[model samples]
Target: MGALKFKFLFAFVLVFIVAIGSANIAEFDEVWQQRAAMAEKDAEAAYDPYPEQSRNRAVEGRNSTRRSLRGYKGACVATNPIDRCWRCRRDWARNRKRLADCVLGFGRKTTGGKYGRYYVVTDPSDNDMLNPKPGTLRHAVIQPEPLWIIFKGPMVIKLNEELIMTSHKTIDGRGAQVHITGGAGFTLQFVSNIIIHGIYIHDIQQGSGGLIRDSVDHYGFRTMSDGDGISLFGATNVWLDHLSMRNCHDGLIDAIQGSTAITISNCHFTKHNEVMLFGASDSYPKDSIMQITVAFNHFGQGLVQRMPRCRYGFVHVVNNDYTHWLMYAIGGSQHPTIISQGNRFIAPHNLFAKEVTKRDYAPMSVWKNWLWRSENDLMMNGAFFVKSGDPKRMAEFTAKDVITAKPGSYVPRLTRFSGALHCTINKPC
Candidate 1:
């Protein structure tokens, strides 16, 4: 009689929990539906300067015949519309800021510091952490207002500490060889509207804490940094492109603490343990608003894992070439929505790391509800992905009609200029 009573009470509690969960799901759906309607209304007039009959932004490049048939190419066959739009131009080196327009995926809306005046970096030395040289890369980043920073010559900046970037700046390294190494790397914290492009950043080590200046007028006592190649903390509308990174102590790129509207494209990442980390900690639930696009990058030799370990945000991993990885790629913990579309994942010979995705700190029963989709992805040498999420819910969430991208097989041509380009004065970039 006692056993029967216990079993009956357990069944009743389970049924009651299910009923409550159903009610919560209905409420959540209704709220998201309202949000989708608002997003549709906004997207109709969302900063599109060249809108034709189609709803796609990349249609300009895809429809042009003269731009596609530029010099030094056989038909100019490429997959990524972003690179096809700008890289084919013979005068790309002259109009370097035109790259600010060649972005796709979620972060296609970012327009980084393009309207700023040019500030040339003539000094390569990073002698003092507190007092930086006026014409150095450190000083250029901390300037007020929007500024487009360029280099005078080839430089190797061994930083004394972290190079913290101010808001509304563009570190353009085209037509010059630039490298930041042997110390802490770039840090983007509590800033906005920035672009970092065409630089080689590697061998970053952890530095001792000191009084460092972030802006032109402000200085504060900073703690020891984690030694990431490019760290973004609470920043928005950031674009990192065509950078070559390797051998960092921590992650190569980390966008944490509610960082949003960011794109990392056309970069080459290698020789790192944790390649990119999207969220910092698990308890910080505010990171749910983070939406990042990782596209057209080459994840090449000597990478261990976490091509990106996401958390709580929406991540679009599109058209990137993953040539090597020792462990599993693309990880997350707290139910981050990951859409891995048109990526080429080449699995290594390691037998234990054939899977392309890993859900950290969650079991099968719990993580099976997370929205991790693999659409039109090319898997070679036994690479595989574990997909989940309800299709109906995913359709409701990504309700905005966006442009469609090409598949992952053409990643090689799309990423032809993946690393830092060596542009001459009289030649194309």
Candidate 2:
């Protein structure tokens, strides 16, 4: 009887152990399932196909308002001839007052606290093109003051001539719209610490009169010879956010002459030849360092020839979605340290398609421009290129050799979200 009791007890213990093991397995499965579901939701949010019609409508309304104001001055003169005579006598006085009001805000620095520490300069009449005053406001918001320039209505700045922007400014659009309707070849040069946010910048083409000679006799050629938009030369620490740029000849954003620490974020770029460019002429080797960060942007239809050229500096391109690109989306000099990672690139044909191939530009580099693609990336283009060397044998090389070795160090480890893990072997999902 005692032997029989022992056998029965052992059977009960074995069954108990099996039950506990099953429970643990079930818990592990549940946890994995929850993680998978969350990942799917996040991807869906990032790649939502819905068009932003409302945002586009808001931009259009502002553009229309600026066009109406441009022709308003002539109408005022024609409608009131008698009043015009009186206005002409006090024309200089009225002009000075109007100019001061438009540029200097009626002798007051702040706009009655409606805007933050920033100032607003929306009137085209407030052009300080010939001689930009030390503290006068222009299309840019002067910084350290944190001013907001509400283009309260749609407006344009027709550059009768060139304009010079000084340093330390922030141009915060309080949701007011602005347009640049003027000579395409006119340039706004020499600016720093500028923040151009929430504005629709488009449709200004190149003009006649071509390149204008500066006071120093250095010909200031327009970016596209006659195109109109913001161009940064020797500028640093600038932030351009929530901007919709399109239809310019050169590029939406161009950084030349070692423009460093610039951030272009949350912008929609389209309908342009070369949406973004860095490095103008490689003649000045010292001026090649253009450290730029481009993140959270959407690049859609009508984008081609986008990227920096030879001898540029560090560029961090992350968290952006590219819908369609006509040619090689990114191609340039081998010297620039480019970090292309964590982005969703969707192209109908071969992605990362390129015309030329070359060796890595520099030696002794670290995460200098490492690429790290998260498992969560919905789409991945062509196979990432690396130097022909066994990565696992890296320990044999000296530190200097390791740094100089052309082999790419980082390998993307993708974590699949669902039962579709088998489908993601060819591409990350």
Per-residue CA lDDT of candidate 1, range 87-196, in tens?
65668767878887776655566566788888999999888667788999888898888888999989988888888887788898887889989988888876777888
Reference-based TM-score, model 2: 0.51
Query: How many times do residue backbones clash in model 2?
Result: 11
Judged by lDDT, which candidate is best?
Answer: 1
Candidate 2: worst-modelled 10 consecutive residues by lDDT = 56-65
Which portions of model 2 miss their true places by more than 4 Å? Answer: 1-117, 125-128, 131-148, 160-163, 181-190, 207-228, 308-310, 350-429
| Cα distance off (Å), candidate 2, residue 378 | 4.5
Considering every candidate listed, which one attains the maximal TM-score?
1
Taken over the whole model, the C-alpha lDDT of each candidate is 0.75, 0.41
